[model samples]
Target chain A: MTAGYVDEMHEAFQTDLVYRSEDVPLECSPKPKDLEQTLHGLMKLNGLVIRSLEEIAGRGANAVTYRAGKKFGHEVAQYFQKRDDVEGALHELSDLLRGQYSFEVWKPEDKDSYIIEENGETFIYLVFHDCIVRQTLRRNGLDQGGPLCQTLFGYVVGAIEEITGRKAKLEIVHTGPNACLKKLVLK
Target chain B: MEIHVDKDACVGCGLCVKDCPMHVYELQNNVSVAVRPNNCMGCLSCHEICPAQALEHRGIYAAKRHYIDIHVCEMLKKVI
Candidate 1:
């Protein structure tokens, strides 16, 4: 009945009733064209989930979304080998996230390296240009830096931690219509 | 990036000055002005938060709107 219900009910529910499937099933192989999904529809659906999470859990929705995203990131990172440096880890991270969270390393005009050390602590700035979370928020007329945004923060931290074998924290520096900036602090 | 503050449309609300993380805007003569355009990361927070829609940035990276539907894009192409 819900977004992931098909996977839960795969044994019982057939192809027609299924809206989406995470894994490929031999019974019904619905092509992209047959899914009947548009960008607006998917974004609005995401908006619905976000709104629902907010209404039910209030500010706590951020924690839920963050945990979910972290789990997703950890899962994705399991496929890749451990990275030695932040740059390599981030490259693999970008490739893994791809269209979902398209981003680039950002630095000051004078700065050359993506990694920056502040008072002996090290971190990197990430400029997320194409984010589905932003699109979903805009579609729902919601503000930025909310629970939906935390999901991304958690995702980046989780992926970085899994890849580099080091704890990481993500902090939002700025949010905008076109892009968002976040600081990834490696612990 | 070049930030232009339309003097005519500016309401002197100080929203842009308050919202900019880079502190690129400052209120001079009760109107928002780009005091430090170089510091601006081109995030466009001021553009969305401005009640008057008075700020514009030139020669900046415009992120892709992959969320837009192809059908709507085609329709908009006809209208514009």
Candidate 2:
């Protein structure tokens, strides 16, 4: 199942890249295993830094960590743009990372929120179950919706902006240690 | 994968039954029971939501566990 998913993603990414620009050179990207390992390390480091800062800075750390996460997300979006358009790249990136990280099993909560397109705008809704961020926060006896969770929020925002070529809005409607609902609006 | 629900600790709140995306839990006689154990993806949403912490899962992907700094934990232990 995972292999098939990976192959489909790779094919989609390649197809999008070709469709975007004929002059863009095609090259082999890093193996999925390598990317997964690197992402694991990065997530660990990010969690550590965020946790330490939260301990020292208390509630004030939320903004600082959120900004840092936003920066990281922007960089990731830019990197994905090298191969495909913003939206396609972001979708591929989200799927690839989710499969690799094993953080949570995301499900579409509502049909309407699944994918809605109207008036040259798009809205996507995703529900994360058993997220690693929430698990870490619970283990540490911290509240949900803290900076750790905001990192993912910022990431989606940054990626959406890159894809839509417009600043998108993101909101977390509900959150708990085991589940979170996030909405992304593209205009 | 095995999921065990403690009957004694259960408050029958039905949170687990309502929250499980896969319908692994079902409320029977006002008590939550794991009816479709195979459907469980080991997301542990039930485990986290259970007010009495009545659920225990075994032989499932627990995901990577992150721990606090050992030195800090040790210091805190002394202070406590």
lDDT of 2 by residue, B1-80 (tens): 68898988999999998887667888887778888887665656687789999999888654544433445678999999
Q: Write the per-residue lDDT of candidate 2 for residues A12-75, one digit (tens) a residue.
A: 8574333445556465467654465555565567667777888999988877766776777677
Per-residue lDDT tens digits for candidate 1, residues A1-187, read 7867777788575556645668666764467555545667877888889889899999899999999889888988988989878899999999998878788888876567778988888989888988889988887788889988988888888898899999999999989989898899988
**For model 1 chain B, the run of ten residues with the poorest summed lDDT:** B64-73
Q: Give the alpha-carbon lDDT of every model.
A: 0.86, 0.65
Query: If you score just chain A, what TM-score does every candidate get?
Result: 0.78, 0.55
TM-score of candidate 2 relative to the true fold: 0.51
The iRMS of the candidates, in order, is: 1.9, 6.0
Off by over 4 Å in 2: A1-60, A82-87, A95-113, A116-122, A127-139, A173-180, B1-9, B14-28, B33-43, B51-62, B66-80
Question: Judged by DockQ cut-offs, is candidate 2 incorrect, acceptable, medium or high?
Answer: incorrect
Residue pairs with colliding backbones in model 1 are none
